[model samples]
Target: MSTDTGNDARQQWKAWHEERTETVSAPYGPLALTGTYWIADATEGRIPAIPGHWAVDGENGERGGAVLLTATAADGLTVDGRPLSGTVRLTADKGPAAAARADHGGRKLVVIRREGLWAVRVYDPGSAGRRAFTAIDVFEYDEDWVSPGVFRPYDSRRRVSVRNADGRERGLGLDGELAFTAAGSGFTLQVGVEVDGTLWAVFADGTSGDGSYRFRFLRTPAPGVDGRVTVDFNRALLPPCAFADHFICPCPPPGNTLPIVVPAGERRVLLG
Candidate 1:
């Protein structure tokens, strides 16, 4: 890359980093999550802080079990916009938190299930984490950190149990690995193939627990038909748990942690 082009890339990275800070501090980002109530322990069909009744449809808690939610006008919740009253079936929210099933004025009530466990998460615009969020510290972009990679898919998808940041064990699905050479060393990261053909990788490096966040995530655009991709360390990002404790970001699966020190990308959170 030419000097001028390299300078432009660095500026673009700075702009991207700045935009990320704004997104995380936004009203509905991860910092806005205040609670996640599982159905098993919500005996009376109620969470301590959330308003409304939430009960699972199947007492057996099967993998595909759903929840039944009942709210009243007095509960101060809305569905799609209008006042909510009466019972409604709620499945795990497949979209973003912004599109959660229940809306409570400035907050969103999101229903989610993990490992056959049903739960409801609350995202409040006025959450303390969002209020305290200031910025994310990042390393300057270096051209040498970017490398070409190949995605090798497995014959079939595989599911592995890993510990989440919430201290719970959950199933993480992997379809392939991205093998690349960076900083003069070879590395491979197990990734999940997104529905849209993109790729998601959760990984850690030597920098973890030394000078950077314990782990970070990297997302790549869909590879071509040949399974070739550009692994850009310059775009490494901190997980949602780095911004909010209420989130359940998954830890890096075995073999996803690299052996070299990755000195680029997001390093830490700067809370105000």
Candidate 2:
């Protein structure tokens, strides 16, 4: 039975690795993100090389409003590859940018809304990061790194204001704690609940910025009624900031940084 379970785990890991390779290599995945231009950076409401005048509109705190993306034939712009004109109400990009159809020539223009603020991302196949990516250096899977964990909620949810990769300070909401033991050492990690209620942890182990990338993310499915879940260090993943400087990923908070070296997951990619 043990042999059979090991074989099944190996097969599952293989499938997951295959899927990850495809995801990162996709046309507009992290490697394809050439630029993220926040509307706040544009003085004349024109983003550099992006053909549109974008602005945020709505009541101060409400979520419903339109992002004015005005263009013309003279502007030589296209929405979903068709000549763009007038305004398009855009919500956040909930998926990969390649799947976003807006284009102007070879560039893929993605509309993104965050916290009711509007922005545009330009993806060019000629992005230097994509050209430089040689291979993702990852550690071989080790079953020992996978263990059961428990989630404990704080007396009340806590929010921390942290600096984003884009040099902006924003609130990162926390829901509870995830506690697990490995190598006879118990550790606790603070985590945020996603819209689907799953827990997400952005963390840095001892290997961070040394043997591996500075930070990694671990996501576990929603915990059981008892707050039990799997703590799978073997599946720890490098954040998008590892692949592109433009990604506005949040840094690990004070307590989220682990003291032990985690040598069981992804490290840096080979850049050419």
**Candidate 2 residue spans exceeding 4 A from truth:** 59-64
lDDT of 2 by residue, 1-272 (tens): 38889789878977887788677766777887878887767767788878777665566522446555777777777776678877765556667786675677777787786666667888877888888888778888888888999999888889898777777887788889999998779999999888897899989989999989988999888999999998888778888988888788998876989989888778887788
Error of 2 at 164 (Å): 2.0
Off by over 4 Å in 1: 59-65
- The lowest-lDDT stretch of 10 consecutive residues in candidate 1 is 58-67
For model 2 the local lDDT of residue 30 reads: 87
TM-score for each predicted model, relative to the true structure: 0.94, 0.90
Clashes of each: 0, 0
Best by lDDT: 1
* Lowest summed lDDT window (length 10), candidate 2: 59-68
**Alpha-carbon deviation at 116 in model 1, angstroms:** 2.5
Cα lDDT for residue 226, candidate 1: 98
